[model samples]
Target: MTQSRPPLNAPHSTAQSAPGALPGTPLRSPADVLGTGVAFPIGVNPRGQLSMVSGERAVTQAILSLLMTARGQRVMRPEYGCRIHELVFAPGDATTLGLASYYVDEALRAWEPRIEVEQVQAQLDGQDTSRIVVDIRYRLKGNPEPRSLVFPFYRSL
Candidate 1:
């Protein structure tokens, strides 16, 4: 008898919207990355490790976008609410030390979310240098102390 309200994180299409020219309302597009004044040098390393200056930028942008969105903000309570427990990276080895730190600090700062990164450890799985993992511990609302969420956020990035 009553229609249920859509959750904050529900897809845009599912939300009630004004009528458009088409049969259905258009879906929202992905968030755009902010422009950074810095420029990156072009070229691959002799070790065969490819680097893209915007790699971390793009990732950080996405994370920020998600948090700022209506859905993300709902979950991201400012008063000791939901926070990132940890950020684990792959390639478990000697590489990715600086990269991991940069990503966690920069991205978390941009989002303005309360998350404590205990340490950035390089995990090496065999000879693969493409993957790196870092473990972090933080706290969210309804909990007195910090806990580890172990979010598998990095997927094929």
Candidate 2:
């Protein structure tokens, strides 16, 4: 079933709901929490790929929330290497795809924002699960380096 993410701004905050909710928003299955926490890496790896790392679920969900919650206000950092880029994504309304689309639009303004998307390819793998991978090809602003990153999403069962 396709379950909608919890509203970012609800009368009942995810933090006040349950375990993951209380400490963090619900993003993945309880079974996967341990592995996601211990195994996933939430930053750029040595390979330079954007790693969902840890907190993939929460981070992803938060991004969704931000897209829904925030209007058109983008987290733009004219300054490079600004940590405030992290605040770009936060929880918002559950109905808005705005943040998701914003993520694509503001792709370059990320942490060390540098690239802009020229093409996007979204596909699904692992037939048994509701998993999706979005591969984005982008061009760096000041360089010839073309970068691509894959983001994976797993819906709650």
- RMSD for each model, in Å, please? 16.5, 22.1
| Alpha-carbon local distance difference test for all models | 0.40, 0.42
lDDT of 2 by residue, 1-157 (tens): 8989777755443334444344554545433542232223346767786654333343333333332333334547233321212333333223222333344445434432333556645444457334444465665444466756565443333
Candidate 1 lDDT over 59-94, as tens digits, reads 443444432233234545443212222323333334
- Model 2 worst lDDT window (10 residues): 77-86
Q: Each model's TM-score, in the order given?
A: 0.30, 0.32
**Positional deviation of 147 in candidate 2, in angstroms?**
1.6
**Count of residue pairs whose backbone atoms collide, per candidate:** 12, 11
Clashes of 2: 11
Candidate 2 lDDT: 0.42
